[model samples]
Target: MNSSPSVKIVSKCFVKPKTILEESKKPYYLSPWDFAMLSVHYIQKGLLFQKPLHSTDTLLDKLRESLAIALVHFYPLAGRLSAQINENTKSYSVFVDCSNSPGAGFIYATSEAVNHDGRTMSLLTVQVTELVDGIFIGLSINHAMGDGTSFWNFFSAWSEIFQAQESNKTDELYLKNPPVLKRYIPQGYGPLFSLPYSHPDEFIRTYESPILKERIFCFSSETIRLLKAKINQVCGTTSISSFQSLTAVIWRCITRARRLPIERETSCRLAADNRGRMYPPLPRDYFGNCLSALRTAAKAGVLLENDLGWAALKVHQAVADHTSEKVTIMIDQWLKSPFIYHIDRLFEPMSVMMGSSPRFDKYGCEFGMGKALTLRSGYAHKFDGKVSAYPGREGGGSIDLEVCLVPQFMEALESDEEFMSLVYF
Candidate 1:
């Protein structure tokens, strides 16, 4: 780790805002699945710091304070989720812990580290191995919170504040009081957000014992681009984005590998940032959860029948409903739901769920060491599988992906030649 003087700087900024929403006072409810996801990230904590610094405490304190401030405006949801879960089920607390171990102490090592036993919430954690010279900051956040894009917004603001302090500049960035949810009319005639509680008698089955799990193969950027181009050619349209293409491919692979029936519709959830797409980019640096879920239908044969291009187009149209107004309305409705009703379960019948966003870049997380080697989701205990992709370096015209899936399904995909060709192209 390279030591730098900027690491010594620390700010005394603090905010104590009062909670306004009733949900703010409630505890977070973690269903049996939620608890499983949170447990997977328990041991994967730590961020690396390579910048030359005088003391680790100073840097950590500054980073924590910066994150806290960035998160202040979005306070109501901050402690609310955890509070709600604890009220109904057994509660667990997420704390920030730091250590300076050799080799594995850096964020680079910890960020990609996964718990084979699937007992932790986040697969990656900030290590901050060497603070005196080189600085590494490992960030590990639960997937339930906003996606990578949202995380980067909060991270960039932290970096900006840190840079200002290092140069002896006064802090000009301050969060406004009572963060408001930009209001908008929702699409469709149904409620903004609702969960189906009545399970069919046939849906009941004997409980299957939990099994140990591991994240499958690491995807490269080159193959992702090929898949996108191929999808475009087949679909005969360019309106679809690379994200849509890759998601379709993954959804297809998972369904086929799992032997899911074609007629059986799978519900896949994609994460969307209701920012610039909204009336105005909701405070570029506004922290807290500024995300909404866009649900898409996952038909098993969709990818096999069409090329990558066609899949991409289909995905784009399927998810078009997730607009800024739709997201705001969804959040409002979720907050208003009864404590006994677990809202996330509404998508359970869909068989699978997927989420992705471009927020990872905004982290501005360069601590002088270098850009983070990898970024991925914390863990998915509820859904059957989850995939998160970020833009790659060098404008590779491809996106880097981090995927979480059932171990058996991942193994079968890895051994299949066709899937490998599409993934690595």
Candidate 2:
């Protein structure tokens, strides 16, 4: 697995819409939050399969064919982003022009990437690696297109259609359950052009930050159990969840590694999904971004001095604050002041953003193949203080954290005795 695998491009093409799907050429407004992601390129998601195919053409054709079918329903992914201004308000907003463009980019690659540790090692970096018996598929979608939930909704649908095609069944049911594209925003919500901007051109300019070291840390079920038990013991309570416990430990370790002043405020920004928390719950198939970030902060001294339970309590409380009433109030706040959404964080110093959910069964995404051997974020995400978690391939309530941090802090974190004791590479 350590050897550098060779990857060769076999074909490059666009998986255009299956039919001349007609719609109003009107643009879908990018929510205030969606504007923040404009400068960011598509988020890369990947899947590894071990199914033996008769030929590379067989796999590529199946993928392109199923993608065309999937895009028929999730057409926005097939479109491009453009900035539009409201003449009367003299303000601007971003929108997706869903008119038939050349569909999503499709690449077929052949590689010799190795598989180990229950999954393919660094397969995402390899475009197409051919082993004796398997192939890997990589997918990219603009972040403005949707958040993880929406992205996965499309992924699940695509997987369903692929499976149906294999079984000679029609995927009309999937097409019928199309994503709801009407953005649910409070009336009179204006363009988010007024948000604080450290860099005024950020929306136009791509985010380019200093190089970051990416590492994958795996926490076993047994390690998590011990950590949770220790946190519960510290608080004399057993209510703290595994996520809160892990976040608490990682945040503390990261802070200590930076060697920041103990008096400085250190905060963890966690995204709370609002799909089911709204007054009228959004459809399970609701597409696009519906995330609200909650910042839990404490003096570095408090975090460093206290046990993990203290940090867990703060995380728990921050999450608890997102009740239906709070969600409604939040919508009102964003409508009244769109600038409150923080896009400036992209250019600012490192602050953690956690994504992916163990609740989502990534391991179960079948595509005619038996099952995915491994699933991961496609790129070595270089954003400062970005952390994404996925259910471990080992499948015993374990978690794998993809951490992107500055090299110094990464070295410090890797060497930290307490942190390393609970983590495996």
Q: lDDT per model, in order? A: 0.44, 0.67
Task: TM-score each candidate.
Answer: 0.59, 0.82
Residue 231 deviation, candidate 1, in Å? 2.1
Q: Residues 221-340, candidate 2, lDDT per residue (tens digit)?
A: 888888888888888887888887888888888888888787888878776788899878888778877877777888888888987788888887888777999878866665555542
Model 2 error, position 151 (Å): 1.1
Clashes (N, CA, C under 3 Å) per candidate: 68, 3
Q: Which ranges in model 2 have alpha carbons more than 4 Å from their true place?
A: 1-9, 20-29, 86-89, 108-134, 171-178, 187-202, 340-350, 379-381
User: Ten residues in a row with the worst lDDT in model 1?
Assistant: 97-106
